[model samples]
Target: MEALQAVLKSNFRSFDRVAVIGGLVRDFAREGRTGFRSDVDLVIHDSKEEVALLAEKLRATPNRFGGYGYKSGPWKIDFWALETTWAKKHVPMQTLEDVLLGTFFDWDAVAYDLWERKLICHDDYLERLRTKTLEINLRPNPSPMGNLVRAIRRLVLWQLVPGERLMCFINEYLDEEALRYMQKKEEELFSYCVSSRWKTVEEAKFYLFQERGSDDLQLDLFQIKHQR
Candidate 1:
């Protein structure tokens, strides 16, 4: 966090709302770990121009995600703008909590407000993190396929067991249709799981079923469907 604070002090002090969000905060809260190989995601409630200006000030390279990336030692910092187009409305986020609420998983719904120099999170975020649980955000209606893939990857990467309630929710809410939807991204999802060190599709399936405990869930469900 010292490195982040230093970078903000030098380059982004003028911005009204700038905070470190997502994986970095989650890891920091859990293990006091920082500078993980994954990109450090930052959220700013400002115009595109302001985001660009800060990137320029920091000499950060722009990326296709409408964000800028900077290398601070081992950390790759990615800053994103908040007033993005959604449902034809330019919804601008006002606080760190608003940004946290928009994330996919409960553990990801945590942030360290640089401006206020404090941590903020959704209710139960810390507890869920402590328990190594994964949850889908229904309010934003995040892509079911993407969340499922991410949940699997996180379970492998974090060596986490699924929470009982989370498993119940998956069994009750995630149906065959949801599994079928993910088939379209099977290859992509497969690569993600393997890259996270699952080694084989069956290994990934084991962890997935560890929570689901459903005979209906099968490895073939994730296999890519070849066009006949």
Candidate 2:
């Protein structure tokens, strides 16, 4: 993972800030939140060419650590590239953000510590990015579990609706690995729900919650203004 991080830092020299968002970021950093399985989504604010150039540079690097590299999209408005296997698989959610989009639908409060994040570029840009970071926390509606349930319903609906578009959306945004795990968990939870395993929903809720502590960020310092 550090190798990928290194490539990103070296290639995108002008980025004001770079963050490993999506599942990889959450797994390595955020806890208590639900986990995901898929490619590492590195979200950075850079131009299309800058992002493409970074992907090109990284793709050139030999996979000493054994990982595939490729690119997708020149979506000018968003400016991101989806790196995945050169060929398609039965996999769902080809991009890193796909799995996260459903879960972390809320806006994120992206803070930058000059002393911490590997920020590049000029001081003025840094100040501007910092200001943007501090002003708002991106909140996505729907709980994490709610997002997962919604995704499953979509998958089921794809069968009933019988359309290529919904299939494509599922393929684009759902993580195959995570989806399988979720299916199994849902099965188990359903069995528990049917079996009257707990006295009430509230009683069962405690077991469903993930336990995590404050040191999860691995940041040098931070102040959580608010979190749901």
lDDT of each: 0.62, 0.35
lDDT by residue for model 2 (16-78), tens: 644454334333323323533335444444444566666566553323211224442321111
Index of the highest-lDDT prediction: 1
> In candidate 1, which residue ranges exceed 4 Å CA deviation?
34-38, 85-92, 138-148, 163-206, 211-228
By summed lDDT, the worst window of 10 consecutive residues in model 2 runs over 219-228
Best by TM-score: 1
**Model 1 lDDT per residue over 8-104, tens place:** 6777678887788877777778777553435678888788888888788789897765678888776688887776412113223665567765665
lDDT for residue 198 in candidate 2, whole number 0-100: 34
Query: Which clashing pairs does model 2 show?
Result: 105-140, 106-139, 106-140, 107-138, 107-139, 107-140, 108-138
